[model samples]
Target chain A: MKRPFILIVAALTLLATAVPALAQDATPTPVPPICLNYVGQPDDIRTSYYMGEGLGYYASGEFSRAINSFTCVIFEIDANYAPAYMARALVLTQRSDYERALEDYTRAIQLNGTDLSGYNNRGIVYTLQREYDEALADFNQALELDSRSVVARNNRAVVYALQGEYELAIADLQQAIETTGIDAVLADLLDPEREEGTPPIRDYDLIEAQPYALLGIIYSAFALDNYQAYLRLTGSNGDFRIQSAAGALESRFTFDLRLDDGTWLLVADFAPEG
Target chain B: MRRTGLIGTRFASSLPLIILIFLIGVFTAAAQESPEPVATPDPSGVTVESCRELTERTAGALSIRTDAVAPFFIGLGDAAFADEDYTPAIEAYSCAILADPTYAPAFMNRGYAFFAQRADPLALADFNRAVELDPALALAYNYRGMLYTVQGNFGLALGDFTVALTLNPDDASAYNNRAVVHAAEGNYDLAMFDIDSALLIDPEYPAVYATRSAIYTALALIDAEAYRSRAGEAARYPNGSPIEVMGGLESAAETGSFATWLAFLTRR
Candidate 1:
């Protein structure tokens, strides 16, 4: 009976101590999920290991090794894995085996209609081979299924630009910028990185890209203000535009200064890269 | 011994009431906690400008707490107008007025740009509607008076200029414009008085000097010396000024430059 009384007293004291804190934390918090970038673990470990090794090789600039690893995963480890086949085909594309890459991409798309990566990869291949109309149609459908789809938007813009529809390309990019707030969509893809299994394209980060957009916009706006000031004095539209445009990560730079009496003068020399 | 033990048991039994009180306090505390703050959407919806954006119209986009999306369009239009790109500016301003039944500034701006573009009829229509929306719009009355004078409607011009003058006593443009109408009707005294009022507000204006010069020139033509030379020259100055010395009609009918010029000016 005494033990029952002591237990009752202790329970009452604990409840009194905890009630106010629980009451203070009554509002529910909104937790957004972390978006994943790479493929996750498959049911089979050998195929997963092969896929992981391939990705690691690709990330480390060993395109040949990545291609070899992915092909082994596709042929020997798991014949039914769509991603394994897709990864091998990407290696073929890096090696400029476009015909074989197109076949694998088509097969992947046949198996899964929702995998935007397959469509985007094929569309890029179509763009490189100059099958513009087909590429545009595929990009348009990709955008329709996923309006937040920046890859489809950017690829379509590239096709439009190659077709001499500069304004249309700019318009599409503008919409993509507004939709996803990704400034890299507007960045020029000057260099095509190639290796055994790596795609001959920059691995532009397409994750929640608000920071990239904000930084790009701020940089461009600053350049605009500076270029406009220069234009006020020089009145050369082409020169001002060239000075303000974003260059490749690696590019040579030259500066030519002309004197009042038509003499070539050198004022400054600097490279154009960030 | 039994009585004291019964009393202690009664005290122990009151513990249920204390536990009930504690739970009620916890429940009350939970009830007193404030709800989480929600993220409210912007009341002014996203305004899609002409360049570097999506669609032109904000039709499907809802601006919270407003049925009039016209103001946002009008704001976009105003920014374009400041850039002096009048074509897109006019399109935006027109859409703004179409969205709102009572946007007077848009009417004023659209009228001004149309006038600059030499679309005079449209300018007149907008100015008229702006004044109708608010009769006390002094700038509208002044512009309407100028348009009427350009079309040779002197009586209407005078009335509008008078109304503008009544609203803004310091409006020198109204006085100058009214003086033009007076000079047309040959009321030189009233015309000179209006010119004087305009000059008081804006001295050293070259156009005012030009107007006064024209009036003096007309007055000097009736002097005795001018009458003799003009009549001797044998040309009948229209408005019934008679010329006594001229060649026969057949002799003077070679090119007919003077008569043609006179006829065109008369039509105007």
Candidate 2:
């Protein structure tokens, strides 16, 4: 899905650390090579050559130069190269040229319907443009492609948050966090053939905390909306407080409201999935 | 004479106390015999205070007692971590660290546990201590670099990532991480190079694919803009036709002069 910017921010706030002793591992790791080699395809060779040049200029911070190289690949090299269109779209997005970016994304999607990122990124652009319905549709399409995609769920949550649908947002965020937890648990439970080659399992709490906080934020926003609606109906103000207590596997988000009678009443209790 | 002989035989046969004392003496002697040594033979010449240690050291040759020590707790932590029982793993790692603060692996592992828990501050502190104790620990630097990158401290992140690469050039993850720094700086070329390096080291690594895809996409847009300047339409592509730009290329190739200029511009 369009890279989950929130998760990126959250991960930055909460991150894992490790980088040594991959030497002992036997697994064939995938590296980010130039990928110029193509078997039995002379045409693909030309494509990679241009792609490599485009990538090089892009990496050098020459945005305009990079765009030209990629465009040449798209127009002069091969019009069917979905990756070239996708690449150009990314640069356009970076430059805030959302119109062309959206077009490129759509073309990329048209060329390769199986790639979910195209839909997800287009959905992001739609959301940015305040086209909530279209954004939701694209996110839905992505989820249909992969039901278990956490990135799609999170992006959809963003759309929901924008629409003041806090409940759905909370649900999506909680699901993303829970999925991560489940993944970590499952990874740990499985036995690898060799200990040295296996990637170390991460701690669940590290991954769960920020999403949990985000869930709480959504709950708070929802509570505020309810309180505002109540105030509008009663023509009076009320005191409200949000309290949270986290357990080993779950956390409780409670909103307590004090009426004119001086008695505290429970308004909302959201126990998001861990 | 026969009656006197019978009386003597009866007196000899009626010595019950003497017979009982003789039996007790035999039983006592058996009880007092030295018991066989309980201590098992140790070919490794290592003294084991607990059965846990004995069994672990002897590979199940001996198991008679349960032991809780630094190494034992470390093993427990490692097991819990493998099971994704992060809470128990952290607890076990804590115990290991408590037992032996100087143990670099314990600190490193505990730091990892903290990281998994999303306790960044705790994780960072543990990582700091781990690196302090063991300067050669490349993983600590790599992790710290990840943390720094997330925190948006690209400078520190770059330093840590570079250090990790210096220590182990084959660390594909470090190369990928360094690429993230380059990407953040808008140096897409270097970013792609680093990612490519990572791919070369570990061709199966999945994360680099995403990064590579992103780089390719970003470059396309950036270069598309450059296409405008050459076409003399600084605002946009001519009639929104990207194909029009290729018109001059065929003629440029024949003349060599225009082709050289186009190549320089494209390469630039």
Candidate 3:
């Protein structure tokens, strides 16, 4: 009887310990983040309405009135409204007022550092001003916020190419192509559903095409340099022939040498076989 | 033998208590395995009027009226619109368009008045004409986006809003409206990001606050539904009733941000 009682006591203790351990090991399910903040206010309505009016003015191509509307929102309604600055900057940019546009972009960035467009557009303006360093910095910052951003990478690549850093430019462009998969972008552009109506081409198609065009230009430059160097070194009056061919997935370019006697020789082919 | 008998009796007497302890431990473990749903605050006050107000406030303006008579008619139209007189505003804008057939603002303003009167097809035609006359006019795109939102064409609405933002990045209202659309689509993360962006642009935007509250309420209800589904028949509030999880349907019936959100959802 005593032995049986001891056994029962041990069994109960074991079960108690094991149950809690099992509970502790169980994983909790994830839930979406919830916000608990103020709602139902009249002032927000009026302010948003005023902003819509300003946008309406902007859409109607009434630059001065649009500017005034946005300015009113900034000065009279809410000074902190970052969108007004951004809107005003856009108009300024359209009117070739880069100086004020820069100021507004800077202010918008200050208000909202996470907005990728602010950085990207500011970088573009800097590029337009020939401020390559500023442009590069802004593009880099934008890329840091979103590493897979093809636009930022492409913009950075443009700056690099402008600075004659072809290698870095090529690397950035290649990475962008990899991240976005140019084929997929092209597929979207060529999707049969788009043929139902005369829909405008998407920006992705244009953006995806840039790297290929840039790469071709860069490669052409390299090939041209080699041809020039060959001419200088060998003092040969041979005609250099360049031929381009397009494939289903890629474009191929080959450089060749032809003597006046009609003898052809392959010099170099930069593009990989598709 | 006598000592062993006493020990056995004592152990037997405590056996029931030991079993009760074991049962308590097991039940506690089982409870811990399923987390209780966090109580969500009621999102009760946001209204459809706020959204309507936002839309109504997007009145068109004629900034560069080249024609002499066009400017006067535009001014008249603007005054009529300000006085909540859609018919006269539409007429004045139409006269301005007649005076200067190429004036894009007249078309845009007329579209605004048409929208106010719920003449969607007419408003859409006017907006399309305005855009055709002046592709650079950001306000036309913004107004068209609002019309699209009302028409339940979210894709077109989003595209137009994007164009408006691209044309004028400072349009806080565009961000707010886009956020509203995202919330309606159950894209809570995107909704939160847009709402935050709107706040960054204008910290005191009341409509954004209302939208945020609606999003929160939606999230809470989603969480509650998830909990109830996971717990099945065993799920219950502190009261004897099961979790009362009213989706966007019930909330939409109430006038406010949720109602606006429901409109978007149902239309989609």
Candidate 4:
């Protein structure tokens, strides 16, 4: 009786595994729609032409006409086109129509969850509305989709900074700089034997500079906060000076505070170290 | 004994409050005036020059070639365009295109002529053909981007500007155009970044300053609206006048000193 029971149990396990294998063989996995490179064009030639016309209107700064053209692309041709929704949402965002923009962005995301820009852009809308938790969640999801995305990291840092999570903000920004290769380019720029007429900057380098600028602002705020605390604790009348070095960089910042005739004077200076 | 004990307890609790009040008074007495720092100079205001005017001045350098006939016609077109004669410019550019159908610059220049005359469709066709003829022609992309921008096709415009920049990283006009598109899309952070890059490339570029002023004005208005919405009926002014608020915002926009403006608002 025990041997018969063992044989039945083994047969049942094999049937369960074989059934799933057969089902897997019968059904094919569906591919997700690509969103990042979505240029808002449709397969139909007429829709594409209208999309081009709408883009022309948008480029011309006739936002109302542009919006109308995009709407035509949506209503007249393909309602399921994610790019149209994304484009219309962009125009709505520019107009500060946050509600409609949110709706459009949400719709675009629904149509294509694979597009990281959808999440990043929607996160921006949330950030603008002061919906920090929602923004963070969107950013986190975006990061989960693409770990190396500098835009998501930078935007998430901004949200974190808004929420007063300074350390987290700093970490994210540092990661952004790393991912953007700003440090490597800066190192190359600092080389003394480099060829002449070679530009020390690129368009993307400007983007990388944002992190450095943000870091400076954060450090400045820290200096001010510390100064206030020092004043509260010591009640000092003498000039108070704090000097700090930027992380992993040769730049130094000095914050000076002086009291003169019942007035406080503060000055911050950035001096690069040799 | 109970009354004495209660008095001691009350005194102990009030001691920290007394100290806190004393500290606040001392700080107030010592810092009667706000902090003083060097002020940033006011930047130039927005320029009245149109986008086309700006682009024409900064348009990509005319493509030089060894072909004599096309170059001659191109020279004629350049002269006419420079003189603001759109008809002759268009005819000359057409002749250049006829002389060399594959010359991307001819198409781009003719497109410019058509654009000058407000013949957008013709200009777009020429620009499109120019891009098709030479995918690497940065000027063609720039002109087409400008046309697309005019036609309200920002996605294509952005694509064109980005392509132009990738082809020629030193093109300050491309940076400025991309900045304008970004600003229009409500991506102020990206807009500001592009503007800074443009200024770095060409500090004397008037269009960049204009773009910066526009961005600052937009930001000031947004901040003002937020302040008003939050303050509601309890809004206060520095001098009890609404004009002061506008004045402060204008000053902030002109000077590009948002921090100063925010401080002014908080003080009110």
Best by TM-score: 4
Calculate DockQ per candidate and list them. 0.00, 0.01, 0.02, 0.01
lDDT of 3 by residue, A73-92 (tens): 56655677676677667677
Model 4 native-contact share: 0.00
B176-253 in candidate 2: lDDT tens per residue? 988888788776656766787899999999999988877766665667777776667646553333344445555667
lDDT of 1 at A13: 94
Model 1's DockQ? 0.00
The candidate that achieves the highest lDDT relative to the unseen native structure? 4
* Segments in model 2 whose C-alpha atoms lie over 4 Å from true places: A1-42, A182-210, A230-274, B1-268
RMSD in Å for model 4: 33.9
The recovered share of true contacts, given per candidate in order, is 0.00, 0.00, 0.03, 0.00
In candidate 1, the residue pairs with backbone N, CA or C atoms under 3 Å apart (3 or more residues apart, or in different chains) clash, namely A91-A197
Candidate 1 residues lying further than 4 Å off, grouped into runs, are A1-251, A255-274, B1-89, B95-100, B204-206, B222-226, B229-268
Supply the DockQ value of model 3: 0.02
lDDT of 2 at A71: 75
lDDT by residue for model 4 (A1-274), tens? 9999999999999999989888762323323222211133333533443443344444445566556655765776678777667766777767767777788879878887876767877787777778889988988998898887777787787777667677898898899888888977777788898887798655463556667766665665566566656556766552444322222121322333211110110011101110
| Candidate number with the higher TM-score (2 or 3) | 3
Q: List model 4 lDDT by residue over B120-171, tens digit each.
A: 9788877766766666677777888888888888877777777787778888
Q: TM-scores for all candidates?
A: 0.33, 0.34, 0.37, 0.39
Ranking by TM-score: 4, 3, 2, 1
Worst 10 residues of 4 chain A by lDDT: A265-274
What level of docking quality does candidate 4 show?
Answer: incorrect
